[model samples]
Target: MNLREQISHYIPYTTQETKEQEVILKYMDTFDNLLARENESAHFTASAWVVNPERTKVLMAYHNIYQSWSWVGGHADGDPDLLQVALKETKEETGLTTISPVTENIYSVEILGVPGHLKKGIPIATHLHLNVTYLIEANEEEKTTVKEDENSAIKWMELEEAIEACTEPDMKVVYRKLNDKLKNYK
Candidate 1:
């Protein structure tokens, strides 16, 4: 598949992502429906590092489950178009009507550990996310609607502010990579 090969071709830029790539690729090779959220063991997820049209700010959501500011994204849900997943998740979570990929190529990838948490009155065990990242360019003027079930608020923030706003230590590297890469994006 295009996604599989693309991910394989993506050279990790950080030592952390580099080390995790082995585990990510192992799961990728071992699973058929690895992108499905219901996989439980682990699965693919698509995330957006959303930037304003002027490229001055990044968008983030106050995640209900994580209880912290984070990039907008969701499970692949059986879909391999991770870019589409990122776009859909951005709009669904932030109500941004104007958004397009900065580039169609894979921006970043990592194996992320999701701590056990309860959702919808059910308990979910700890899992890993083969998280793929993409950069999106969106208009700052677009009105955003809250995704009440997933997030309490959504806002465009400066890169430093956005990174510091997140409380998850593991996610910080993801955000930093996105931010640093995006700085060089046209």
Candidate 2:
């Protein structure tokens, strides 16, 4: 299915998601290249809520720009298949070759705000990430290495500890919601 149809059919887990879902769909209509960062103001991004088989732990990366532990994801970069984007990012960011989706459906949706920051000495303007998240499972036994350009460290953290380790207040809520959804997953 196409990105619009996927988001259209998604049953949001929160009012936030429902609201963001609406905005995402509208943005899809309003922008010419919604999947690429060329639009500048807002663009599509994909994230993986990586978890262990038992779902008791989450794989997190210490993001260089955010300066905090965060979920692994990246820009859609013109890719309409956000699931493939999410999966590819999970491997690149975490250095884990063994990872797979828990389901093909989107696990959550959010319109995330990005503060303007310098990356590789170039200043980036503030923008919005029309973020799509997928639930992914990885082998905890596989060793993880960080992608130096993006993150400084990577680890498998206990679910609650992962929340505590993340310094972004808004993301803590998102993480909590993702963890809560685990009960109904699978």
Reference-based lDDT, each prediction:
0.87, 0.95
What is candidate 1's local distance difference test score?
A: 0.87
Predicted structure with the largest lDDT when compared to the true one: 2
Q: What C-alpha lDDT does candidate 2 achieve relative to the native structure? A: 0.95
- TM-score between model 2 and native: 0.98
RMSDs, each prediction?
1.4, 0.7
Could you estimate the TM-score for every candidate?
0.94, 0.98
Q: Which residue segments of model 2 deviate by more than 4 Å?
A: none
- Clashes per model (N, Cα, C within 3 A): 0, 0
* Total residue pair clashes for candidate 2: 0
Candidate whose TM-score is highest: 2
